[model samples]
Target: MRLAPGADLPVEVLERPDFPVNRGALCGKGRSAPALLARDVRLTGPLLRDRPGGPLRSAGWPEALDRVAAGLARVRAEHGPDAVGVFGGGGLTNEKAYLLGKFARVVLGTANIDYNGRFCMSSAAAAHRRAFGLDRGLPFPLADVPHTGCLILVGGNPAETMPPAIRYLRELRENGGKLIVVDPRRTRTAELADLHLQPRPGGDLALALGLLHLVIADGLVDQAFVAERTSGFERAREAAMAHWPDRVERITGVPAHRLREAAGLFGRAATGMVLTARGPEQQSKGTDTVGAWIDLCLATGKAGRPYSGYGCLTGQGNGQGGREHGQKADQLPGYRSIEDPAAREHVAAVWGVPAGSLPGPGKSAYELLDGLGRPGGVRALLLAGSNPAVSAPNAGHVTERLRALDLLVVADLVLSETARLADVVLPVTQWAEETGTTTNLEGRVILRRRAVDPPEGVRSELWVLRELAARLGVPDGFPADGFPVEAERVFDELRRASAGGDADYAGIDYARIAAEDGVFWPCPAPDHPGTPRLFLDRFATPDGRARFAAVTHRPAGEEPDAAYPLYLTTGRVLAQYQSGAQTRRVAELNSAAPGPYVELHPRLAARLGIADGEPVAVTSRRGRAVAPARVTEAIRPDTVFMPFHWAGAGRANSLTNPALDPVSRMPEFKLCAVRVEPLRSQQAGAEPAGADAGAQSAGSDTVGVDAAGSQPPGADAAGSEQAREETAA
Candidate 1:
């Protein structure tokens, strides 16, 4: 139940059931989504620049499209297909995402096309594919979470990060189910856990190995299941036994007694599920760590049951769907391997392109950004719905290279930090003013319907890309005579591409979507109901058996030392979203978390003579930033937490290290050594007075510390230092 545009209503009245609910009810953040659609700063028309520093003058759609086509053609002709890379984002609609891959493979003849999802979820995807022969969220539906005897949460902070999923956790708790949480920080989710194991940062693999060691040593492993349903168990067991409780304790900082207790409880449970997030997947050895986590569930025979399996809690809005539809660097639609000849042939037949038209797999996100500004590197970049300046690891280097690009194109609803630097800014429609489908963490597909018209000049990404294709004279482009006019057509194309594959969605149609609020994938035919679980009897592999990956613990690429004695981990706050492009503009949300601040242990702060809300300059080997201190017990004494939303004054990315995993190539955004110092008297007088004043200054401007030592104003300094000090000590 949603109200039409211009329907005046009070907040309290809208909250009542008597008044119409907005699209089956919205969360606090969802309720404010309508305001994002009403922003006037949207880029409606395209603009072109004659020179690098020239002003961007508005041009007709045809002119803008022609210029883009000509520029791309020239780059390809002069350098090569690899010279022009396509960097996509996870926020695009399913249709747009599908087309982005298609455009890169068929039209550009370049395999150098990858989405931002590579940076966010590639490690989890790679690990799951290696272990389970499948990469969907969980084997069972999200509804089954509440029925489990025990739930093991690793790395993730679902209590604050994923509010929608919290309902199931609450239901499970009400039903007397046990919750076990493992993280370096005692996050909001940890507070709700019956048992919480605070492991050291980048020590997740060691903890997982220790749990497996205890399971096997105590004779808790399911021998029958391992013998019949898994491979390589003997080797995995050997690896697990190599890391005893004492060794794990030394590496992970978790007491050997506590780990054994948690292991006993988990091994004895009749049914259990394991969930992991960035804490496990944002490391230099992320893939190996995730593999160890999956191995634990398999060893205990917890997968493929009603409420049991290993799950990766994805971060992006459409992270699952984006990877499924060939937006990844080495994947075709349907989770098919890009290097597999048969899979490539099948996709080529459906797309009506030459078998060899698709270029070879491209470089990962870290490599692409690192290559920028180097010899034979990317001269231009087209950013779709991403703010690399604030989100990318080693952001100082990324920002420097971004400024060196010959051309930069950014497409988004608002002027994000990345967009503010674009040579051409294209205004796009927001979610509330568009219609499509998005696959959530549980693999449930839901409709994204438009309740109001887009603001003046704003157009759907589909419309913008289609116009560009026509201008570029792309062969057999979608009908140019008129607009697609319907979102269902694009979904149908995705359905065709995904048929008979791991992420099959052929059964779901627009009519079914309208009739039902949502449906899960593997909906392979019109009459078939969606599948809620997968691999119940036989695995998806040729042998119908799950593989046991032998995993080992490895230290993070960067470790704390004498100069930088604390590990800095990056994450999101409850009140802010990624990069805060839209949420920061909301007065209420902004007031809740106005700016960035470092969360440190009170003991660490006291040692450095830093008070709560004091300004502290946090510097890594790669870069540095100055943020307000937040001494709290949420983190360990030798560890710190910082949000990655802010940019100018104290962006987390600036202090992040960019060392990547060899397998997944995901940057180590979670663990990096940093030195924190109280800003001196000279630095304390350099800050501007207000938010607007600070933002107006460049990223290099001096930021003064307040009396309490926090950023001058607009900085978040909630909670007390005593709690942090006591917890750390």
Candidate 2:
């Protein structure tokens, strides 16, 4: 095969005799992944500075690991384990992600370790685990999406976000499946919907409850299925009654008649499924909102079927895997709660660590950030893979506290925004330059083969962390042997960790992955074929019955008022990935979405005296930012949308409210109160103005925004800082 410019040469390019060359399909992003790997500026060394916010100087492996180990030891010894927090990113390999959680609990003896998965999918996870006795991602393959008779998409924009999933949706639509989209904005996905219910932000629960209420009140619910397969139905039904379509219409802005029609269509369908994404989860009431959606599925008898289930479209590539590997604050491997004695004991026995050594559930992302800069709070942080500076909620407060940390260590492939604030920066290998396994959205485990050697001086995160473990004198009993080594060893550890769990993969090994493109989990042995779907008959619950959780509607932490009358919703643009650390560097990707721009309804833009390409200021209680406004009817009049991937002058997080869900602890990234106004020429000029052109001059150094609206030099630094603040909080 011919190589792209600067492409890393693979060890061998053997031709497959049986399979055709074009057998496998590639999405747009996947096709671009190879070119991205060839880009310059990949990090390849360890760096350290003498003081906080000081210049970074290159250091050897030994020196870098020693400094990191010594600093962690010092913090633990002086301020206790809680003083040191570890933040993880979802982009990490399964092996590295697993070790990160184990290192925090055992090596540092700190409970304060959580990954960006919390912000991406925890509420959906919590809801699924509660209702189905398991969280099996989509519960079915993407192929099944088109077979369903009815598809209800809530709080997601799969058409813009997940293009492959959108293809399946389109196929389903073409094959007679009705598509109903529920969201505050009339997103691109909504444009294709048979019906689009524009709910008010944070009103997802009310909408869901209203659906269930209609299904129950009109006798459209499946009584036989509910009675035999579920418990707690009466309580959920009672709660739903209070949120009838008429009442919910007032709260959600979705018309009463439309709500009733949508509910009836979904309830009467032979196979119906409801899907959600980051939109519903990144709110103060995210968990309950998710629970309400689950209730609808249970009431309508839509779950556990081949073409039906409650789906939370995971955001990160490995968000589902991160949760399964115990990167959450309160979880061990296999979705076991850390607080559960039995679960804790099971994991401890597997890892050869005492149960007492594993701390209970710790502070969540929001709480950790709130504690930063406070007396006796987190003094140091170790960040990996995640860029939080431009992504985390309440960007203004997080920035202030981030500069106050005593020690900050960031491990990443580039100088991301958060990494710029680091006391030490460890260069790490990129995805194409490393070998490992990653679980996709449908729980399919695919191998990530190394196409080329890592850049000079750059090391895999596994190698760096293993060296640190040795220097720190962590007991050899920990799975350190798998470090700085082959991907097979890491896969072995993962298999062992998942033994006897719902996501068991002990039977499959490295050899099988090489021969087969991928396999779903629960392949307990070599001869056992992988299970494509989960929960075919009964749930994992003891009684073999799914439970209907009672959920209540709650308002967002902040509401629209005279000062900030517009509701601000944050999301992604087609060209930029989350945080825009890597993709923004690609010229073609950045060219499509050059900089931050507020998406407004034409009506709202007219009211606010704003126009396309005109500068506008969007202000919230937490902070404010200015960006060019694109007036279109894609969104509702009362709501405005902005991509959170951009930082610096138009950082969306800066204007996002920091109110967190009580259960998920995820910030309200989806909904916040803001006021938008046309930016005067003088005001626009007074601000540090260049989309990407002058991004390197001032605060742009922190978020990595270059002068041309591309990722700035140290945007990875901002990512590291954001990760630290979110974890330490």
Candidate 3:
């Protein structure tokens, strides 16, 4: 970040010129970071609603903290500790993420705790861990991308999502490397590929299997590497052989010749890599689908080699770190399993708590949200750094679950969609005004320096957690060092808890991170240099061999039927960040990508008599949403794409399916069955569906961002009036 000395706001947010990943480039989201600090919509202090369905009002720190503590205590006393749920986000710093987990278990002693990161890349993480006994977004850094001979990008559009990283793809092609892109649409990233395979939605598993079959048939399998460094290949091979090119073509809608061609390109290359994003990872069969992709890498000798492996393109800030720390549902600090007794002992010791006192893994993100306010489910929830109301799959249902909660506490920088519905909202400090550590996609731990002071009355998450813990009646100061409010103090304890663990951050300190420009993880000792490239000589498995998954293609949880004859896929746009909690409030960003629109194939649009920019109603089994049509040949004929960054009328997630991967517990957010109908009589607000989500003032604030897709007669206008009356009251 380039800021004038002592200035309240940054002059320009520039990428580090020497950084290996971004390499002197900044994406629109990165550059717009300053706009968040300047926004008037930022929540300056705590807000409380004393009763159900009551309007929130300002409260002092003491009163608000007391109310939150009392509510949580009431829930625990009435329904037991398990009823108090703690929800976190991927955007939180590692300290905050770790502290949140500690707060849930050590303070409140609840098992019902999870975070939004589960929605981002849980499937990929599961597959990676299953294959290599460890889960890192990328074993090799982004710097290895340009050097690889061939790159198969599955379900990722980094050109739009991560503009700065596109240079690697461009350089790969310039250096004569082949790029094969697999997606249901010919996205901007796909346009750059040497071969673009537009498969059917949720057909990525079949596509990967087809590619693997061809690799073996063409004698491209690395027999020597597989025999020496892998296990379970025979079963995986059998599964792939069953998925012949012709059979795979039938399922994925890709021609056999193209599958063979894509296979040949990857197989012929001396080095190769496969990277998947939400399109493949956010599915009911996402774990198996990702396993299929990893199987391809293993078959082609891509694992445990330089510039070759399977990686996940994580979509959230601190995504790698958030999951590695204690925030995830099933993990302890340093990515240790919560079910592991030894891991429990170590983390408990660090937290100064009895090992037996720690709670077991509760539920994944969607399950926790889905269980809200139900019998024997979570009654009071403390959510921080996430806006599941807009981001969750089957969002309409999730939003209502949130509303049903007896106590909803949200800590955020702005009045986010989830915050607006919060019974008690605590204004929290954001990135620029908070100092902490974040692990980037490459497993690099970087120290975040506070550039400026936060506005008065705004507290840091560290302070919030400490105060809450105190109010919850911790005898000692708490968490070893009394839950010190300083980030450095908390980090020192994190280093201890992470020692000798999978992600091993003991060697990494604030000093080391700053001096090294960010240190990669598995730095087990202070003298040991961080492992930038993992699994070079040996994989992390018990026998020093990567495991190949024996998996086969399965149909999506919900396939297109007569009632819902089309596939609905959701993704990110260039100008908006996840859930659009902060990005949508930025005027420049909102102007660039102001509204959500359904991207449909030209033929599909014509068949439905829907012109470009015409409002189209997309109805699914769960709900319905209305958005403008973007008719183009870029998308598949049987599929429609919606960017899941908006709310209200165009809230795409409302129509997404909640069918979850059994292993990863990740919802099928990317694909669901839906029907498109051209709207002729309905008209919602014209200022896009986003402005209504977190609007501050009443009457003028657009309303009716429903948990249900289709509203009743005059519900939209009536919602607006109700919002006005509430704000006035």
The best candidate by TM-score is 3
Whole-model alpha-carbon lDDT for candidate 2: 0.76
TM per candidate comes to: 0.90, 0.91, 0.93
Of the candidates numbered 2 and 3, which has the greater lDDT value? 3
- Largest lDDT belongs to which candidate? 3
Better of 1 and 2 by lDDT: 2
Alpha-carbon local distance difference test for all models: 0.74, 0.76, 0.84
Candidate 3 clashing pairs, residues 3+ apart or interchain: 477-482, 478-482
Q: TM-score of predicted model 2?
A: 0.91
Worst 10 residues of 2 by lDDT: 689-698
- Tens-place lDDT per residue, model 2, 29-112, is 555555545535455566667655345656677887888889988988889988989889888888778878888887777888
Q: Each candidate: RMSD to true structure?
A: 7.1, 5.2, 5.6
The C-alpha stretches of model 3 lying farther than 4 A from their native spots are 1-15, 475-485, 681-729
Task: Kindly list the per-residue Cα lDDT of model 3 for residues 581-669, writing each as its tens digit.
Answer: 77766667877988788999989988889999887777787766777889999999999999988766577887888899999999999
Provide the lDDT at 346 for model 1. 84
